[model samples]
Target: MNNNKILDVAIVGYGPVGQTLAILLGRMGYNVAVYERWQALYPLPRAVFHDHEIRRVFRMMGLENELEKVSQPSACYQWFNADWKVLVEIDWSAESISDGPFGYLFNQPSLEAILDRQAKAIGNVQVHQGWEVLGLSQNDATCELNMRKVEGDGAGETRTVQAKYVIGADGANSIVRRECGIEWHDLGFDEDWLVVDLQPNAGVELDVPDIGQWCNPARPTTMVPGGPGYRRWEFMRLPHESVEDLQSTEKVWQLLSPWVTPETASLVRHAVYKFRSRIAEHWQQGRILLAGDAAHLMPPFMGQGMCSGIRDAWNLSWRLDLVLKGICSEELLNNYTTERKPQIQAVIEASMAMGKVVCVADPQAAAERDAKFLSGQVPPLPPFPGLEQGLVFKTAKAGVSGSLGIHGAIERNDKVERFDDAFGRGFFLLSIGEDPLQSLDEKLLGELNQLGVRSVRLSKDGAPGTCRDVSGKYHQFFEENQLQAVLVRPDFYLYGGVSTHSEIPALVQSLCDEVSLKREPCAQLSQAKVAVR
Candidate 1:
């Protein structure tokens, strides 16, 4: 064996995003390292709003069952005004598909803890908590890095490392972005806010079950249940008013006094922050890249800030895995930033719009905005437009050529990674039970196994009537639900399918050039099922 080495990946700045990228790539058998500035973890609840793709990440990481334990079943939600007037009190349990409104609410610390533990569990990720990246640059061959332990009262020692690629998941003030000369567009957030998380009283009167929001013009509050009696109420600070002396218990009680008795509210985590919107002009330069808060920063209006970064992790994870495995050309990795940037920008715009509506304290604007929805002129916000739902995105820039329109932007994460017997390649296809990876001929199945294609045949357990599998595929029971097996590609796209078993190999070949997948599928596709549904 040649002693000389080829660098796989080096991830700079080991926060949640960096850590997540390391874990994801490590799972795909890529060599990864996470460099962090802090010697220890930050004990703050940085992110709270957990969404759909987040749940999918947990599922992919084999932590879904564990996450389901701490996860409180948040089904009922109420959108009310200061007068306790109901506007949109949606029982999320009713809407589980397409846009599954019912999800979990855990602080960023808890979620990060899970990801960190899982990354350690992968056993391949080397973590350097106190090491700060000195600098980075890349060429066509590989990327280089400089590092040192954060300086103490004495002086810090220096170190150097190299890798094939570098991901800068550092926060908004990213050093790697500076190295790459990446520009960012700023959405002015001259206004700032205070978040006062408090506990609820025993006999407080409100119709909200677990998660609720007070959408009053003055002092809007969101009641997010953390655990048993503790609830979070994020209060937007008024103009010219900084959250001075907010750490004191008295001040917290005073700010929340209008809503409830001071004795009833307990201040758990209280702080102030200026909300801003910014997306990095470019996400990658040569082998150096950026992710998470480093690439895009959005206000916490919809709680998708970290969620969007997690989405980035999901998108880039498999692609990097493919390149490292020599399954896909490294050029395909260039599509990583291309595919994700526009989507994240759209998310930022949506979040900014939501912030305007949610933070509108002016009576006239609030009434006009709320009245349209109250009067039923416009439908209640569809719980964040999703891939399956109607999606609108920002147009691509000049030279960003492709036949695929915004669909590529919105639907990128829609495809599932199914893992079963026939599938090879480290990534799973994520299929439904009914369309379980069809029992192919032994020779073909063995060939896939030899090629090491990782696949899964999911049986949607306890799915009522008929439902799609985890891979967004159809199984034997798919007829009732109008689904056939959706063949999800390694990059997590619906590669074809919606037909049946035997027919998959041909369909797979056309979608991904991994193997000799034929065009003519063996399984018969039901046309009547399509027309009926």
Candidate 2:
């Protein structure tokens, strides 16, 4: 750890969120240092689900092909009652607007390993495994991290590293969060559950549930398929069950008796976890920020525990890039906490709601709840919430800003590929009809060019320098929404949109002002289009 040079960012805890942020920053050509107390990946599986929106992020990292190797597309998530009657079913296999499956099932260790490998490959990212963060403090110029090497050659040695900014991606019981004086705002839902992961014995024959919720009052349990030949079961701790009692190996097998015995399966790992729902009162303080489990914790009923953390990383990456590159003010980073807190809070509430459904204990209460759901009076599933506030421009020509941007396969060269792969990353100006550049004045175009924004003209048929919307969804999205052009952020969220070509310049200027783009550039801005063909 070099103490003299001022690094761009220092990340505490090199879990998935920390690694993702490190990789994103490294790819953007920033100097990053990640400190992890643990020298290796946590061998147990924790999170198991991610949606298409997250898949798009993986696509942004250029890891879609690698991700497919470790993930399995999930089927519908169906809930059943004591009598085996269906309560509510969420169809995860349904196609999303992003032109992919609604969700995916994966092992957390595999996902983290993929992120770690990619992050280490980046030229500027340095991983300090076995280095434990001891304390954090910030002066006017930089934040200083005090760390000690916990293992290997430097076992008991202490050192200091300096960075312009520091982020805490440490898990729950985060030292960084505590050092920043952030408190937890508990959502009040807590339960003790046994999480058991196992692989079936060779040639074991038995009918097992595939990703089903058994809501029986006798024992409310969840069985989920984890990739190929792997299964997970979560059994809720009953009223009479004690944490100590449930932790015994003999007792654990008893809970698994209904599903499998030691004869029929090989026990991989089992642990008693008290699932908690909590979010930090403040996510950012001065030059320090918190992400992942350090910022929020949620029940895994929706499988969003890890997904929300990954979202935090992606949401902060671009903003940090703009600020570090001096394209935006440091105050812009405040949007991270402002924007992510509400979104993660919503996810926590929704997960708690689902937890209430699956954690029912009393027979009468479970029966009444199931009856209400079975009698065709069920509540509709909540629509995915968009950015409600912070940094989003809400008053575009069509009032469609703050919504998630759509993705589709584009025809380029002799291959069909994801839009991001063909168009590259960063701010994008996409038009459906005419070339959007024709509509922009030199001043607005110069502003966009100076900000490193790319312009793409999309058409149904191939044109010189224009991308072909092979899926036809991008064109249909424009037609259905009555939008001629849209400005999309790097994280695939709508910055703003214009209904007519004439409104393009104004939209560009609005975005320029919102992002605080510089008027001058190192070189004069040019009227150049990104060559896709």
| Model 2 backbone overlap count | 0
| Whole-model lDDT values for every prediction | 0.60, 0.85
Listed per model in order, the count of residue pairs whose N, CA or C atoms clash below 3 Å is 33, 0
- Which regions of candidate 2 are displaced past 4 Å? 397-399, 463-465, 520-524, 529-533
Q: Which pairs clash inside model 2?
A: none
- Least lDDT summed over 10 consecutive residues: which range in candidate 2? 524-533
Models 1 onward score TM values of 0.75, 0.95
Which candidate number would show the highest lDDT if scored against the true structure?
2
Residue range with the least summed lDDT across 10 consecutive positions in model 1: 403-412
Task: Kindly list the per-residue Cα lDDT of model 2 for residues 365-452, writing each as its tens digit.
Answer: 9888988998988787798777777767667644468778888898877578888777777888888777778766777777787677
Error of 2 at 317 (Å): 1.3
Model 2 lDDT, full chain set = 0.85
| Candidate 1 per-residue lDDT over residues 234-313, each given as its tens digit | 77776545567555667777766766656655556778777899988888787777889989999876668887887777
